[model samples]
Target: MTPTFSQLIRSPVLFLAFGFGSGLAKKAPGTFGTLAAVPLWYGLQFLSPLAYMAVIVITFALGCYLCGAASTKLGVHDHGGIVWDEFVGYWITMFMAPAGWLWALYGFVLFRIFDIAKPQPIGWADRKVHGGLGIMLDDILAGIYAALVLQGTAYLISHF
Candidate 1:
């Protein structure tokens, strides 16, 4: 069942899994959830590249558990409200990106496009994977794709 706001707030895991209530938005929860990640990405900017990677690694592990647990609790697979994947995905998109709001915005747009479009292996993982790992794998792939594009764009702009 889709969790009510009260239920979602009351459960710590659900609260995080739902992207700290941003996923509770009535429409386009993934988009809103991704937006919630923007500020976090800003804070993560202060970290050294190695530390930033560590955070992503840890968060990805936690997301697998959280997303899986929430799915089991709700008896739904890949619930729109379980948007922690989007958070991780956006983080990956911004890795090594040029430091600026415009770059962040570009990463945001790119991540969303890849995530929503689900090209190739992303779509395959979404369809074939199961459990929490399954939930995160697709978004991880999307993030990687977006990151490649974002980094490539940065490189091109710098060179040209």
Candidate 2:
């Protein structure tokens, strides 16, 4: 039987599970899940960039623990519902980008490609690792890849 929203949210395993629920939508749940992180990014912007980066670091660390517990409880491997990783990964992807829709869109596209393609080390981590940290690490790598590519693209554009 399918679990209710409350059951999913209230699970002791991970607070990120509730956020991951955004990924449960019929279409592009991962995208939706990433989108769900926007408000959080905005809210976090109040802190200095350093503090914001620290928060992301903490969130990733905590996400590792929470995601592992929640994934076990749900009896699914990297279930769609566990998208807190995506949220954090996407946030990381936009690290130095402007807070405009254009940049957001670029980040969305870049993150999605990296997440979906799972190139090299990201793919290696996804396969060799287990639990929340394992689950989130791949996405984090994807975000990093996207960030690097986007940063380069922006630099190239500026030089033109």
Candidate 3:
């Protein structure tokens, strides 16, 4: 069942899995969910790289269960409303990124592009993987792809 805003607000799991209601958007819920992550990213930006990475690791691990339980309740696989994956994915993309909103915006666009395009193994995982892990895997791949590209671009711009 597609969770209504009321339902999302009422349930803690749904509230989190649905990206605090950003995923309830009628159009491009993933995009909205990713956007929601940007502000939260600011909070983590000050941490040491190791601490930041630790947070991502924890979030990813917890997300598997959070997303899975949510999907089970909704009786759907990878519901668009199930956007906790997007949150973690975007965080991964921004890992070690420059401290600025421009970088954040760039990471957002790159992550979204890779996510929507779903090339190769990312697409493969999306089609083949199951449960919450399945939902998170594709976006994780997309974030990795985007992070490589973003880091490369940042390096080039800095060096040139």
State each model's CA lDDT, in order.
0.95, 0.80, 0.93
The weakest ten consecutive residues by lDDT in model 1 span 1-10
TM-score of 3: 0.98
| Model 1, span 1-160: residue lDDT tens | 6788899889998999999999988999999999999999999988999999999999999999999999999899999999999999999999888999999999999999999999999999999999999999999999999999999999999999
Q: Which regions of candidate 2 fall more than 4 Å away from where they truly are?
A: 12-15
Count of backbone collisions within predicted model 1: 0
Q: List runs of model 3 lying over 4 Å from the truth.
A: none
Which residue pairs collide in model 2, if any? none
Best by TM-score: 1
What would the TM-scores of all predictions be?
A: 0.98, 0.89, 0.98
In the range 13-124, model 3's lDDT, one tens digit per residue, is 8999999999999999999999999999999989999999999999998889889999999999999988999999999999999988899999999999999999999999
